[model samples]
Each structure stands twice: as C-alpha cells, then as structure tokens.
Target chain A: MRSLPPLSIFVFALSLLIACSHEQDATAGSPGAVDVTAAWARPSLPPHENSAAFFVVHNRTDHAVQLLGASTSRAGVTELHHMEMDGDRMRMRRVPSFTIPAHGELVLEPGSNHLMFFELPAPWVDGEKVDLHLEFDSLPAVDVLAEVRPL
Target chain B: MKWACLGLLLVSLGCSDSDAGLLDFQGIGGDFTLTDEQGQKFSLAEHRGQVYLLFFGFTHCPDVCPTTLVELQEVFQRLGGAGQDLQILFVSVDPERDTPELLASYLQPFDLPVIGLTGTVSQVEKVAQAYGAFFEKVALDSAAVYTMDHSTRSYLIDGEGKVRYIFRYKDEPERIAQIVRKLLP
Candidate 1:
C-alpha cells in the first residue's frame, strides 16, 4: 500500500476536525436539545370557544432561543399571549414571541405567558392530549403533547 | 361618670364583634342593577342578605378569568354547606360579546352557583365604577379581534351588601373561604 503525501495527510486531518466540530454544532442546536416539560392545557367548555395551554421550555444550549408560535389541530388559530397586571388590572396581551434564556427556562404557566387556542372545533375534553407544533427562531419545530385538564 | 364609661365599653365591644378583622371598604361598593344570564334584571340590593364574591371578567378571557372561576370553585368546595349562602356574581366587562346565553353556557362547566351578569356597556361601566373596578376594550391584531383588560380583584361583599374584602388575583382559595365563612351566618 502506498502512503499519502504529508500535505494530503494534513488536509485529511483538517477535514476530519471540521466534520467533528460541525457534528457538535448540530447536536448543540438540535430541537431535542431544548426541553419542553409540564405541558398542559385547560379544557374548553362549549359556548366558550377558546382555551389556553401552558408549559415550561428549558433551553439547554448556551445560546438563547425564541418560541415564535405554536399550532394545534384542535383549534382554528393559535397565538402567543401574556397576562400582565397593569395596576391591578389583568391585561391579556398578544405577544409575538417568548424567549428562553440560555441554560434557563421559560415558564408559561397560569396567570403568565400562555398559548391561546381560538375557534375550537369542539370542546377539549378532560384526559385528552393536544398535539402542539411549536415553531422556533433558531431550532427545528418541536412537537409536544399537552394533556387537557379541567380547571 | 361610671355609667357613661360602661356604656362606652359596651358600644366598643359591639363594634369589635361585628367589624373586627374585616377591612373597611365602605365607599367602594353599592347597589347596582344589571342583566343576569337569564336576561332578567339583577340588582345588588336583592342579594343583600347573602355573601357574594363579585368578579368582573368576560367569558372570552382564557387565562385569568377561568383560573379565577376555578379558584372560586375551590373556595365553594372549602365552604362546604356554608357555600350555599355564598354566591358568586360574575359580571362581564365585555358586554357586547358576553350575551345572556353565552354567559349562562360559559358558567355551566364550572358548576359553581354563579349568577352571570352582562348588560349594556354603560350599565356595566356604572357597576364597575361603583366597585372601583376598571376595564377597557383593546382591539387586537389576532383572530380574537378584541379583548377586555379588566380589574382582577374579587370583591367579598358581606351580608349587608357592603364590600368587606378585596382579594387580589391568585389569592389562595383557602383564605377566601375562611373569610367567607366568617361572613356567613
């Protein structure tokens, strides 16, 4: 077997290093790297056509991430919303995106940020699971199943 | 002089017995009439003898309002038999959307004894102002079109139809029930 030249060996080693670093970058920023936990949604009652879902998004990466929006088959439209207290008044504002800090978590809980589902085809019965497709700014879309709970 | 002192002591004792541990919100609430979920007139004076949890919110409110209702349901559960004497008056700030039937159906799922109330915009505004509650309609860019930004305080009215305690948002249900229990007969 013939051995390669010194320059060829150097090029091969450089390519291998680049490939390994690219793999690390892909793994670090993958959708699975971000953790979405404690996902749950309130049941929608009839004549009350809307409901909300809450969860905690843990961004394990060193870089911050943005949750742009979410979608579910159960509702006609979904939007990001935040409930804030403006001098004792509860103001529900439509938010464009929510940021999950690096190595930190964003809690979308009751009386805070939430995903509002509007125009529900039917009531979200208890014990059912809502499949949510969450779109992000830098990561691939993450799909989570939120359990419907009666408030 | 001794008789006067004794009479003064008796009056103070009577006052303490009736008003002790309750906050004085004397000028905050009064009698106001609005349309009930049954499409009939409902005046606060009619519920004078009953303890009431008065909350201003709309049915389209997905977060705070529903959570408040659920907390109230827990409050009622904690009250047990006394819960019967405790009534909840849910006044919708969004009068245009929360009609009588919608308000009725919106409350059916909670199972709480709530008298859902809605009326003309001016009527709701009058009652809200009377209780020192504030609300405004904001147009949204989303499919919801409009949402009401309203006060989240739940007024605890005693049997005399006077505001006794104002519960801040997310106040524990147990605490509310304990207070309501004290106001009950």
Candidate 2:
C-alpha cells in the first residue's frame, strides 16, 4: 500500500482538527437550544370561544426534543392541535406531542399545527398578552408571553 | 396527473374567456334575499351590475374563515379602482350567534366594507346548497358548546349574477385578483 506524502498527511490532519473543533464549538456554544419565537395568538372574536396561538420552536441542540404540551391561564383548556387534511376536507384534532429534530424547527402557525385554547373566560383582545407555559421532555418548562392580534 | 392536466387546460380556457371580456360561465347562483349587516333587506338581484365574492362562515370561526376573508381582502385591494365595483357578501351559517351586530364587530379588522348577511337556518342552508357549499353545526361536548364545520370555498359572481368561479381556500390573492380583473368592467 502506498503512503500519503508528508505534506498531504499534514493537510489532512489539519482539516480534521478544524472540522472537529467547529462541531465542538457549535454544540458547546448552544446550551439547551430550544428557542421559542414569534409567539402570538389570534384574538377571540367572541368572548368565551376557542382561540388559537402560533409560534416557532427552533431546536439547536444535537438531540431531538419533544413538545409535550402547553398550558394557559386565560382558558379553561389548552391543547396542542393539528390540522389534518382528509381528501379535500380540512379537520383539526388534538395531538399528544410534537417532535423537533436536532437543529431543526417546528412551526405552529395558522391553518397548520397550533395551540388551541378553549372556553376562554373572556375574549383575548387585541394588544393584550397571554401567559403561556410550554412543557418539554427533560427540560425546564418555558414560560412565554404571547401577544394577541385581531385576525 | 390527468386531473391536473385537465385543470391546466381549463385555466387556459378561462384565460381566453377573460380576454374576450365575457365569461362563458354555466349559470349557478340566483337571487336570494337576506338581512344585511345594517338589519335591512338585501336582495342579490339589486347588485345586478356589479361583481361580487360570496363566502359562508360565522363569527366564531378561528382559522379558516378569518384566513379566507383576509385573503379575499388582499385580492380586493389588488384590484384598486376596479375593486369598487366588487361587493363581498359573507353569509353566516350560524345565524343564532352571528347577529348583524356581532358580524359587524367581527369584520372590523379587515377595514373593508364587507357586507355580512344572515337569515333563518333553512334559508342559509338553501343558499349554501345553491352555491355548492356545505355547513353543519358540530357539537363538541355535552355542555352544548358547538362549532361549525363548513366548506371554505369562495364563489365569484359576475356582473350578471352568474357564478363564474369557485376559489379554493388556499388560492393566492393574486391568482383570484387576476380572474376578478378579467371579469370586471
């Protein structure tokens, strides 16, 4: 078997070092990298009705994470809901959990996956904020503020 | 794939119909009288010379209804001067909760003059059937809480009050605007 030239061996070793350091830096720099962004809810048009909230969950960690569920004080029941397409019909149902892949994002937005609040005591008026508690597996629950905007 | 190809063919033909300044649409909608947002009698025949978009929804709808109306508003804004000739009729399927006052307040965010219409359950059902739409009251639990499960399609009616196009809920505003501009005088 032929051996690599000295110069080529040095270059290969240097490249490997650089690549490994970059990955280490990426993982070490981002601790508990589940980020919640753009949290907002659509104002309940009529009081005591169901309302929906939207947000983007970005996981920068090197391992997958599961969004177990959510809670809110403004409504009697808060559940994770997903919109399903059956043939041409669109339907919504409660989902037990959602997964966010390592270094990926899970977006909960209008007409897709969303957090549904049911039987709100009062309408989530525009310009007001709702307190949200997001639970995940093996991580501290995240307390978030979601603003309400008129649809 | 075959249906997609056929749809493309129909779209091309629709484009030609637009160019001809006459939409050779199979007649679908007819005159119906309902109470408007102002609690006054509204007759479809009265708007004979204007183009209009019609949708079936209620005040309590969270996702689909609001999204569709906002998209239609975008289409109307895109039409600019021609938009003035376009009227929007939003018929409430849940007549019990969607009074004229509720409808007016629910639609305030759009900042457009979208007329809200509602009537007796059978009256609304008859009109929805005529437009090839579906709606039902879905009971959620034993507490008597209910939600409406309804179709999300919007109908485009021309100056002659003939249904010219049925826009899907996901249709882009620009795409609907293009067709509406073609139908407009």
| Best-fitting candidate, scored by lDDT | 1
Q: What is the per-residue lDDT of model 1 for residues A1-151, given as tens digits with 9 covering 90 to 100?
A: 9999999999999999999988866754754668899999989866747889999999988889999999999999999999888778888889999999999999998888999999999889899999999988877788999999876
Worst 10 residues of 1 chain A by lDDT: A24-33
Top-TM-score candidate index: 1
iRMSD, per candidate, in listed order: 1.0, 3.1
Per-residue accuracy of model 1 over B112-156 as CA lDDT, tens digit each: 999999999999999999999999999999889999999999998
Candidate 2 chain B lowest-lDDT run of ten: B18-27
- What candidate 2 gets wrong by more than 4 Å, as runs, is A1-33, A46-48, A59-66, A85-88, A101-104, A119-128, A149-151, B1-23, B141-144
Error of 2 at A47 (Å): 4.9
TM-score for each prediction?
Answer: 0.87, 0.75
Candidate 2 chain A least-lDDT 10 residues: A84-93
Q: Which residue pairs clash within candidate 1?
A: none
